[model samples]
Target chain A: MTREHLLPENDATGKQSVLDRYDLWGQYVYGFLLRALSSPSLAAELTVSVFDAFREAKETGLTDLLARARETAVAALQTANELRLQEATNFDFRMAQRQSSDDGLLLNEKLGKAQSALEPKCKTILEMAYFNGLSQKEIEGALNLPDGSTGTRLRRAVNDLRRVFALN
Target chain B: MDLKAYMTSGMLELYVLGLASEKETREVERLAEEHPELKKEISTIRKALDEYAKLHGVQPPEELREKLEKSLDGPPTQAAVSSRPMVKPAHRPRNKKFQLGWKHLFALAAVLMTIVAIGMAVLAFDYSDRLAVATSTNVELKEDLSKVSAELVEVKKANTNLQEKLGFLASINTRQVRLNATRRAKGATVLIYWNTDQERAFAQWDQLPELPEGMQYRLWAIARRNFEPLSDMQSVSSPAGDIHQIAFVPGASSFVITMEKADGPDYPNLSRMYLQGSLN
Candidate 1:
């Protein structure tokens, strides 16, 4: 791998470089947010928010770049969750809305149940990656798992989730 | 190299999940670029995940799309391009991979050929050295054979001479005479094979010790009338059983042998007499 391949094509013009990054990774970030948030509007909003934040960061590493995007999306999701809680002042109204949202909430509920139903090790690994937002390397280090096996555990967790979802 | 093994390795699934490390992701991309089947497999896996995500996708609010489009109006910043490391898909031609493979094969073949050539040269040199030694040995054997052949001829000649002497001794006119040892020459005895008809005498020096270096034994023919010296004598080089011809002596009553100086005097040295016998 050459240095040119590793580095961004042009780093001098920070403006155009940021736009290029948004163009390239915006869809991928949106896709990941859609999976995590299960809401296209929120995913799109978070995707834009990630790029807006990425424009200011000086880190050149690609992994760090993706991490920044994930952090932005996760933080936005947390803020939305806090806002939802705050707005739940009317208990009867909230209950009625929750019942109505139950149609869309079924898949989310099923997915969450599938994650929880996974083997303890797989559950922990998936939780670390999705909920805690730890990288596979971080998961390996934190769990004292051997190198290269974190990916294996993640793959297994996803497969197990698929099976659990299918069984339901 | 085993594409099936690579496909089933679970690494591609991790890549799709974005759980793969940067290095592993790059490796997957590199291998997928190199192998179209792997690339197709990656695409299939991505499509499956895409379908799954889309099944649960919700339509975004129209205002968010508009806002995202407006956000892209500015010039490309360093962070934008650098944020997602764009991997330029490498075009690795099959011919290039084939060329590299062939180059390694040729290099291995060249080394093996050199080793074989060296082995053959060593064997040839060793064989040549052994041939030289064998040739030298053959030459020596031939020379020895020739020497033995020459010696065989000399032995045949000696045998013929002995046969002739045996024929002469078998004649009826040949007298076999034994000379007795005298007091001064104890243990000295000789045999005389005399052909009286031919007046020829041959003497055998029997039990004769080797004389001193500068002395020799002489033969003398004695008669009552005169002390007649017959022939000069010396240590014989022939076999001990051989009979040698002396001077012709007739009408001699006795024969005597004596030790004398290497150059014998005309008169016999009586004190150095070695053997005496009467011709009775």
Candidate 2:
């Protein structure tokens, strides 16, 4: 579904109604947290928390929703002891098989391909920085890279993905 | 700086991924305001990552939906539909007026008396309803007035504090001392404004890492060959907005900040010193 379709419209009382709109993007949010957290239960709990905060703030746009989801997930990752398990596992760039037969499959398929095409090192840096919420220095230490290489690798990976998407 | 080169510097990617330091984040934001292309690039990176996350979409457990619904306060109830008031039918007089006997006249008079009593009762109910509404409105106005008065007091207090800060900072007697981060905490810095005339000092910092549980930061003035405590132990999470007033020593040669146990330390723990600066 498009971003516009996911926005909660105001009801007769002039308050934004979110439940139905949430249904449209709940899986998208859950998937994000699930991959970042690797625990269905923690992801679900944070998913609920994100939506709870979103509704209270009466946020209108899709970008705000996604940003909030990322922020909430990052905060939870910091406090959660389960991150040690995530750290032990090797980084994988390939997207897991899509479970939901949703309408955004075409767009997701293209995105999945672009993500999988990234170099292994690039993928590892991106996942560590974005999903694991590690700082550039932390990623550098973890990967045994030089002090300033994490940003360079991340930029290359993102540019590669952007180029691939542009070709499509 | 060349816009194209700056765009390719990977700072925007780090920013979008939230891997950039606070200083870098601020710089990126400031540049984005000057260059629309930079803003657009940031937006594009953010969208790409968001979509990548979306590609991994896994439907949450079915039971979770029910649980979230139960947890949330349900959508607000629809506004109560108001029904239009019924209009009274107009009274019509009969074309032929028959001569009335005494009994008929007596019956007519009793009916008219009952209608008048009913009208008076309706009027009394309507009057009482309006009076109740007015009373409620008066109470609300009083509450609003009290809230505004409290807010006014707070504003005035803040204004006074701001004026005092400005006055101190503007004084020629005030000397700014820069505290460089020590090896214990690299990249962290603090500034101290000491007004020699008044022997009062204030400290400010950009950001500081969170300390371990039950640990707090204490300031020390290295003066007269003694480490004198400059302020009470401060929590790392304390707000950075207000300029913290620190005890100023007249002949202090330097200043030091160290992390110490929340309760036990009366003097600086030299090994835990995080920042230091000399008056010279």
Candidate 3:
């Protein structure tokens, strides 16, 4: 879908209609949480909580909604001790094989290309840390990398991703 | 701090991903507050992550909307209500026999009034103290704001300079001419970015030898067969590291830099030539 279709239009009054925004962005927030938490049920629960909080806070922007959803998901993961290394590994596989048509979501072409251009290990490290919320030491142990290498790898991966993005 | 190194260190990505340690987070926040470039970089990282998240967005189950609406429409739970500060009951059940007499009521009113008076006095004093503290904080904040504003001005100036240089380098019409050092100055090279479209040129050098006192470097643009003297002579003690803008003579076949006495005629001294480069 085009961005115009994905984004909610303001009402006649020119102010963003809250329910419209929720409808438009709810799936994206859910997916973000699901990616982070790796559980459909937990992701669903937090997605609802995120929207409720967003409504109560009178936040209309997608950025704020996503930020709140991320925070809520991360807090839930921390509280439930749900950081699963296996799930992160699976996520890496899914990311590699993921296609825009699979989800019927408007994937950002630039970011998708940039992400796909990353080395497998670098991409996995990013997924483990960003999506799985694994600490540097946890990532090193999980990947069997030498001590202090996780940070270096993570930095290089992110830098590479940024460089690729800049190039494209 | 080497901002380029810090920016590429990936700490910003980690920070944006909410994975940075508390100390690292603080450092990033402090630096971002002080440096506009860092702040811009942080913003870019956040945007990239946000886009990445959006790229992987999945359509939630349809039933999820119903669940969200039900929760929104439902009344607050007991736990939710209990989390708020307790409010006194608007009315208490009356007992005729336990009612107070007029004299008791008057005495109670007097005591309540005394308590209220003391409470008001205490509140007034607290308010005054808080007001004073707030005023002091406001003054400090103003000072900090002014300092940040000054720093912002300087950063903007630097940013403009960098942007101009980048623009010149990126322009298709701009030609990069490397001026090779002559026999007098070995192992020295200068880069000149000449923008033909804008008729502007900038020169940069790394290791040009220091000239003697009262001697300066002059630039000449050779257009056709005639030499045009470009304004802005560079002294050795001047900022050699900075990219210096020079007059761009149109259709210049070549350029030359020569060292001459500070008081010498405004012309290139062929014998004192230090570097030369041709457009061809």
The best-first sequence of candidates by lDDT reads 2, 3, 1
TM-score for each model: 0.32, 0.49, 0.46
Error of 1 at B46 (Å): 3.0
Q: Write the per-residue lDDT of candidate 3 for residues A17-44, one digit (tens) a residue.
A: 4445656777678778877766666777
1 or 2, which is superior by TM-score? Answer: 2
What tens digits encode model 2's per-residue C-alpha lDDT throughout A23-141? Answer: 76777788777777666667788887776666656554556667788887777655552333333132232333243455345546765677678998798788777776766655543
Evaluate model 2 with DockQ and give the value. 0.19
Where model 1 places Cα greater than 4 Å from the true spot, the runs are A1-44, A47-103, A109-117, A130-133, A161-168, B18-23, B47-280
Which residues of candidate 3, in runs, are more than 4 Å off?
A1-16, A58-60, A81-114, A146-148, A163-168, B75-280
Docking class of 2: incorrect
Q: Which digits, one per residue and each the tens of the lDDT, describe model 2 over residues B50-122? A: 6677666667778877766765755423333444556799977879677879999899999999999999999
Off by over 4 Å in 2: A1-3, A6-16, A83-112, B74-280
Interface RMSD of 2: 10.5
- Rank ordering of all candidates by TM-score, starting from the highest: 2, 3, 1
Question: Cα deviation in Å at residue A18, candidate 3?
Answer: 3.8
lDDT of 3 at B5: 86
* Candidate of highest lDDT: 2
Tell how far residue A108 is off in model 1, in angstroms: 2.6
